[model samples]
Target chain A: MEKLQEINNKAALNASGALSKLIDRPVKMNITMADVRKVEELSPVIGPEEIVAGVYLPVTGEITGAALLIFPKESSFNLSDLLVRREPGTTRKLTGLDKSALKELGNIVCGSYLTVFSNALQVKIIGHVPSFSFDMFGAIVSQIITEFVQKSEKALVVEIEIIFELKALKGYFLLLFELPQFNAILRSLDSV
Target chain B: MMENIEVNMGDLVVTKNQDKLTTSAVGSCLVITLYDLKFKIGALAHTMLTDRRVSHLKRDALDATSSSARTREGGNERRHEIRDMKYVDAAIDEMIKKMVTQGANKENLEAKLVGGANMFPALKSDIGKENVLAAKKKLKEEGIRLVGESVGGSQGRSVEFSVASGIVTVKIKF
Candidate 1:
């Protein structure tokens, strides 16, 4: 019984260590209102409601993980218009081309945020191709959370709202860490 | 003598000779080809979306609706002048009309379907499923029989229709 307890204790410690290595220490990022302002400067007429931003850090201590940053349609469309330089009314609908542009924007935003993880975890993180879809803000957030969070044992969801002028673009970022990879990180840390 | 003709999306092609009509990268899209051995007439259509209320020509214009509406309106004249057309419904319709014009009885027409694949797994929306369902439903309503089909999967498919033998050979991603 004592031996079994010791083995269990070691397993728990290794698991915790992996989580620590996969994600930043605090779990939540300290993104200020000013950061939102800076992001808005890249576009025009950001949102009429407060924009939400979030980050998901994998807790599995894996060297590679997935990160997702979602933006509301209003903010997305505004940013797309700015990036593509289409005059207002000329392109009121978000067509396939507009969706592609938005995905590119998401790629950039997520890429920048991943740098923070790289510095914190001291591991290389590469991203897959980003995809974009338009829907109600709450629906998108809930769906992402439901699909990525509810399925995992323990997950962290970081949320923030960005307000610019009368417009607000809500954001949600989800991070998923591979369990096996995280275990390896913890084992390596123990050896060190 | 086998003629290899490329069928672009939203376009339809038909031939009675032993020509091969082929299209690449079919996703959430249906390729409907009809062959009448009696008249040696073959027709193929590549459609991205499914809708019964609209014609293939109208839908193709709508697919490119991002352009100015005026351009679309004015382009109609040029579109009409072109004999080759695209759109699943319109293509099928046009093919039927042409086959009849070329001595193919409407009652004798038979179709072989292929190439509806779900290329992007992450996309929760199943466009390929919808396309297949739409094609089946429309064909049934129009009194056309689907003799055989190769539908939904994760990989893209290349489809080829041989007019001479009415054989459709679908090659999965090499």
Candidate 2:
């Protein structure tokens, strides 16, 4: 537990730094290690049926899982405005360019965390190209969970808080690992 | 008074009173509801997968007969096998059983299907489609008429089923 906390803290710092540089604003990220839940019991990060923007990045190598970044409907619109450099509150709908920008954000933030994890565990980890979706929170989350449930029944929930330009938004980063892969991660970290 | 009940993933609920069964944020998952008007009994299931027979973990476990072998092959794999209700085929059968146990006549039961949406269009996943197909197939095999449906597409939906009226309300955001 302590080791995971340390790794999580480091990853959050690195991710925030990368995001801050990309957006050209001071971004603060706080990660709270939430509970390890049964895969079926993996609750929605936001309102289950609330429409939100989601970026899914699949991870492979030492472990197989995914990292999902979610922004509530309002936050997504606001973030899109900032990313596309439009007037504040001006992005009522996302264009192709806006979608690309959000996918890049997923890559940078999720990539940074994976980098730290690979270094700490000495495992080869890769985050694949991101896919973007604007849909119900329950739908997006459950789809991702379904992909991983065949291999693993436990999911780790990480509550993420992102603050920038005096505004704060809530996000969730979930990690799902197959039992064997999970055990391997633990064993590798224990040896270090 | 109409009571509301929330059905989570891999769960099913049956009631005969003036109650509403609801499940929200259904993406690729399928929500199956069975209603018997005469008895005023309704059952709802929030199922995530199509068939357990094709599950990799299940296949591996089946290949290994002994409990010791299953555990030795994968850490805690034996204990983590998903419940049968998580699959559409099994969930439908189970839901019907539950409705019957709650004083519903099998002949009067009609089914409604909701959800089965592909939330991420870029990803090549047919789980949602397969889940819908499986449910339809299972319902037919069981001789249950499918009265209504709101499935497919890339939009997520919320579903509410009222036993008293046998009405299913499906909603999507934009």
Candidate 3:
């Protein structure tokens, strides 16, 4: 477990590097130890039914699971504007170009995020193109919980907070790995 | 005290009187609500997949769905397992039974459906649409009158169902 935690931290750091390259700016992202909290604690980070924009990517290989980038609805607009070089607050509604931009960005970050695991475990893994959505945070997270990963009593997840110091932007990244493959992932991490 | 009982993803609970039943962020997932007007009791289920028969799915999910898959070809040692509300069929059945145990009349129960958004656009099959169809078919099978629904968009929804008023309020967040 300790080894896997170390790997998780490294993957998170790799994600930060990838994201910085994507945005061409410095972003401070913190990775925390993962656990599913009680609903009281869960509601605020995700919001009590707050609307959000999420980009979901499937990670498939020996150690399979998924990852997602979630943003508060307003944050999505701002992020899209920043990515496309539009004036801040210029994107009131997400256009086709915006959605495409978000998907491409998610794919790149997730691809890089999973690359760390693939390298550590010596496995060949691929990240699917992310599917983007604007929805309620709980609904989206629940879907991933129920449909995407193997059922464990709780989720093996890593929470990432991405902060743009100058822009005052806040966003989140959540990675959920296959519950049944915990030992498989750990063993792979140990191989190095 | 009128408490707000939360129904988790792929789970359900029954509440009575001033108490309300609530679930959040139902996207591509379905929230089915049952109300017994006379008893002021409410039940809600947050369901993800439509059925268990599909082979391509790779979730290590709970409920009878996965268990049945696990026991498909085993020798006849099957007895009724504990009920789980993760699947749509079992959830509705259990919700109805729970409502009955709490003084609800099957004849007087009304139903409302919420959630079921197509969160995954790149995927060809629409799980949200499939969930809606499955729920509608099951409701028809159970003879439950479908009062209302907010489904099949690219958004998430939060629902609060009050049995006291038989009113289910839905807030869509996009």
Instruction: Report i-RMS for every model.
Output: 15.4, 2.9, 2.4
Query: Could you tell me the lDDT of residue A128 within candidate 3?
Result: 76
Candidate 2 lDDT by residue in tens digits, B15-120:
8889999988888989999999988999999987875435767445333432333343345455444336777876887888888887889999899999888888
Best by DockQ: 3
Point out the worst 10-residue segment of candidate 2 chain A by lDDT. Answer: A38-47
Error of 2 at B133 (Å): 0.6
In the range A82-166, model 1's lDDT, one tens digit per residue, is 5466653354567777766656545544554555444434666776666453532222332232222211222223333333334
What TM-score do all the candidates reach, one by one? 0.44, 0.84, 0.81
Please give the RMSD of candidate 3 to the true structure: 4.3
Q: Each candidate's chain B TM-score?
A: 0.79, 0.84, 0.84
Q: How do the residues B46-121 of candidate 1 rate in per-residue lDDT, one tens digit apiece?
A: 7655554335544453534322223345557333322224335656778889878877887778887775554434
Q: Which model scores highest in TM-score?
A: 2
The sequence of per-residue lDDT tens digits that candidate 2 reaches over residues A1-192 is 666777788988998898889889788888865557655564434667777788998889867888788778888887887788888889998889988898888787778778887888878888888899988887898888777644236666677777877777777776767666866776665566
lDDT of 2: 0.80
Give the runs in model 1 whose Cα sits over 4 Å from its true position: A1-192, B52-86
Q: What TM-score does the predicted chain A of each candidate obtain versus native chain A?
A: 0.49, 0.86, 0.75
- Candidate 3 per-residue lDDT, tens place, A36-105, comes to 4332355666775777778988777665666777778888888788778788779999888888887776
